[model samples]
Target: MTDATAGGPREVPPEQLHLLTEFVGRSRWFGGKGRPFQVVGVRRLGRLPACADDGPEVAIDLATVGFEDAQEGSGESGQDYYQLPLAFYTEPQDRLEHAFVGHFEDSDFGVRYVYDALHDRLAMGCWLRSFVDQPEGPLRFHRIPGHELDLDTHSTLFSGEQSNSSVAFGEDSLLKVFRRITPGANPDVSIHEVLTRAGSDHVAALFGWVDTPALRQEGQTEDQVLTLAMLQQFLRTASDGWDLALASIRNLYAEADLHADEVGGDFAGEAARLGEALASVHRTLAEEFPTEDRTADQLAELAEGMRRRLDAAVEVVEGLAPHADRVRGVFDALAGLDGVQVQQVHGDLHLGQTLRTVRGWKIVDFEGEPAKPLAERLLPDSPWRDVAGMLRSFDYAPHVVERSWGDDEGAQQRAYRATEWATRNKRAFLDAYVGRELTPAEQTLLDAYVADKAVYETVYETRNRPTWVGIPLEAVARIGES
Candidate 1:
């Protein structure tokens, strides 16, 4: 182990970087999975204020991984940046054995046992206290005007989150730490801050956010610093909408005499409520951001993009070959769309992204699609894209329940009932969103968006869940029908 001083930044020993690369590759949140990556550079972000001086010192770094060898011939692949928050100690942390990266010696700090620091309670206290104290220097903390943060509350790290780490403080507040570095803006924090100030009931209220002025990218503007974490009021009593939908499906399947609408766990009401919540959120986003009409050329370009994706998707997902032309027809009709309103929308809206509280539905995660580039996600798109996503989710809920029953005696009967539940909920949701009978032009637009989403899902399912490929494939068929 190498030696390091306290309260300062230092380079990680170059030889031990391979350990980090291995840890990253094995992680679920790491983007580059199938491809190999090498640590190209490391920039120390800042040290957290740890209470235990005798214990391990905590620090964070942004590590950039390059896929140069694998992508040598291909021009598209580039390096990815990962946020690494680590605790370094002279002795082993038995409690953090699961999160241990490796035993390494830093040049400035010798004989250190390194671990991912999010799991460390003392390391997390630095974040909670920062909101209350509003500390000076490179690490800056800012809060909304009125709310006072509870500095004494202990934080509980949310497990199994993919893109970011979140800590909930016993119904007081929740802190979402952005793991990947994006210099400009993260809509998840920025949008929630706006909604909370507006007194919107459909979202969690924002408390504060933490940023560091010192650790910025080389070419980024001087004013732009990384958005380290966001703090908002915790939805203590909130239940997941996806879980509720599954429960509703199960309730429907259990009843022999009752249809979906007649079942005890009828989800039509919840679906409509969710639609209203989404519509309210869309309105808020439209007011906060600019809303505009796409020119004829832009509409054609949008249609072309969908067609291009379908063309590419058919090559990989052989099941899509039959419906490719029909799906293309839906996209082709979008060329005639005129005066269509486009604005900032929940690009990845789905049942899983919503919560059903005692008051009503609360929509979260305005960050758009997790996989898309930040710039593309920020771009204005049709609100129908959000509608289509939710529609697909409604379809998925019942079918997943049907699958759980297996090829038993009542499988076919359950399949029919699943379709019934999905249809009722989808209709209820769409009616609430549009608030009127859809015109032919609106219907056509909706169809195209749904087709585009299904094509995207096909590609995803083909890669990740091959067995679940039937869901989107079936959607593509019926969606293209007259």
Candidate 2:
């Protein structure tokens, strides 16, 4: 039974509120890092349907975190929502010492020991069973029929993830638990659902997802859907595309005499395959989703948006100041264009977002830019944005390897080889993707999108990795030359 004393969902136990605050502060998925922030509120969403008669109780809580220094008029409130799933036990489990949240006296269960449910296999089993069983509750488990789930498999949480928590159940399925909470359709689940049902081989097939009706806050008219987790086919044998690219770069540098194309580990062929995969996915999206040609006014607005971003980026990235004018000129060229097509795309396409399975290339993560709000991420964008992101990623791969060399001998030679590798792969990818020579308008669009993407990279690197800011700055300098 939930308390409805305050005209809202039940608040987290007052004594346990501090525990959540401390847990969120140290969490890897907490987005408010380096900012003055606090857990302002925590409300119990619901308890999960028990997996067994004697299994630990599972409960989901939503924490409202407020940032003290959020910028006004940034199109965001000074707060964020995070989901915390907890498992309660009668006794503290020594195996889950690292996963402990806190202990409390429960009125129903009494003397409860709480832990992050994601870290507990038994707790995760409840989630898996819910998807398999489809029990009625606040959390709805929607499934796509085909493969039978391995219900007996144990869950192991992946440690390398940053923004979200992923639990792999043996080798069969992966459950991506979204840390940040938002009240709308999640593009990741939605896009994967579409591509999977369409029989697209370029993406991981969506198995099912967990969502619930969002708690309507003050001033809200209607309830919105809040997605919690997504279950999908885990590519157990898949290698990360970024790792593959880095290895290719490493192979190139080892043979000082050989060009990128002549190397045994040349990634040009793979790059072309990836390009074809992207093109196929884009065609499918354009067919399934609403696509439209931007009028002259919309094109002008798009250009203005890019210009504004450049203007703001120059302030944070001092290196961008020199290349700002050239980049601005590239963006300014977009205003004259018309009939630029826009549709749903991989919002943040990069080599890192790809997986090379035995079958071929598989793109993942359709959530777009992590920094942007969900509404902005769902908007239709030109496919050139995706193309430009991959192009920029190709540029980054070799340069990243070169940076590791630091002031070593053959640095100059390595730099030249890096350029050769990036250029060759970029050409191979672009040729395969477009499948023809670009028209003047297409070239204009591609150039602007690439320039815009590079500009974004400059800002991101400046703020996150100051020493590596030179990578994107170099790309920025070549804006007009290409």
Candidate 3:
């Protein structure tokens, strides 16, 4: 925990402080969970310079702390430091939106506070200074009437396991405040920059960004995600790909007595259309960007990495061994192929990462796997990795729904129907994708890519989410049997 104050600061009342601490712990945005946490300390960053008529001067800053016990209460821990950046607004009844108050209680001295470190003006100002000079470029700031600005400050939290905090503004603009900041230009910003420059309509438009020059810490550069605010034409009636798929699955299950082709709410059409959109996007990427032939060494490296991941997964779920071997065979077969095209691709593609609007299916978020190192995500790879990711997502929808509905007979029936729906749409999508005439080499490459993706999922699910691991394990088995 880095201190933002010049020197040490004072503390609040024990009851007020405890209320604040408890309030923070209950928040959905708060990352620290399953661990005992005490304030350890708090420092008021500074007053938010009175806006008008001597209103509340919002103070903000970081905090430092130590665990009560090293290894007993919270499983395991040492002197762990945390970045407890916060914003305190005195106009609790007026300025505070009380975003998550319904989810958590705040008693007396209940000043409205939000974990707004990501989009803090200071942070964004810092980030912006690095790329462009102040008062120019994409990082422009001006003082508007406080009342006018207040009306425009509508904040709604995005729902998902996000790597950062995002709040949409007026449906036309989006601000993605990165959580775990890295020094380099983030790929999400970088890729959107290219796509927008290329006049690509398939992706959200990139208006601009804010960044700051980082300080040199030890031998490394330290940069934070001040703010990556982008303006785009928001889809007014757009449905996320996950919702669309879930709806389709539910509809199909409801009409399971009818043939999928004859079903009223069939997803085949959407799937085919999405497939076409993806193909178009891929073609554009290939045309605008350079690609290279995947060398044997590169393939070997991928194989080794995949093997290690699979081995770890198998250790966790012994039931996965048979499926793992089959998935391995697919990779082994692909390794023999020559001249596979390698290019930059969406390293993490899934239903949640797409949107279906009046314009059609538009891919969103190009940040790649959040857990992977930046270098690995930026690396050029087979486009099939993306394809496999989508396919796996398709498989997850029904299984997830089934789990949600419980493991009763009714749930199994719904799962079965959903699987049928998924299979039908998957074929439809693949047909649209493969229908594009391709060289035999391209076909081989695509197959290998899909195999690699399934293997990746197998490892990921097994490690982080044991319950969902079976879905990818099943995919590996099916791919092998095929």
Best by lDDT: 2
Candidate 3 residues 364-424, lDDT tens each?
8888886565667777777877777777777788677666665665766675676776688
Give the lDDT of residue 5 in candidate 2. 30
Better of 1 and 3 by TM-score: 1
Estimate candidate 2's RMSD in Å. Answer: 2.0
Ranking by lDDT: 2, 1, 3
lDDT of 2: 0.88
The residue-by-residue lDDT of candidate 2 on 1-482, one tens digit each, is 33333124454576776777889988999988888888878766666777876578987778888888888997656988899988999888998999998898644446799899999988999999988888766678899999899999999999985699999999999999999987788999998999998899899999999987757766988877788899999998899999999999999999889999899999999999999999999999988888888999999999999999999999889878888888888887898898888999998999999999999999998878877778888788899989999999999999999999888789999999999999999999999999999998989999999998888888989889999998899999999875
TM-score of each: 0.93, 0.96, 0.75
- In model 2, the clashing pairs are none
Candidate 3 weakest lDDT stretch, 10 residues: 142-151
Better of 1 and 2 by TM-score: 2
Model 3 C-alpha lDDT versus the unseen true structure: 0.58
Over all chains combined, what TM-score does candidate 2 have? 0.96
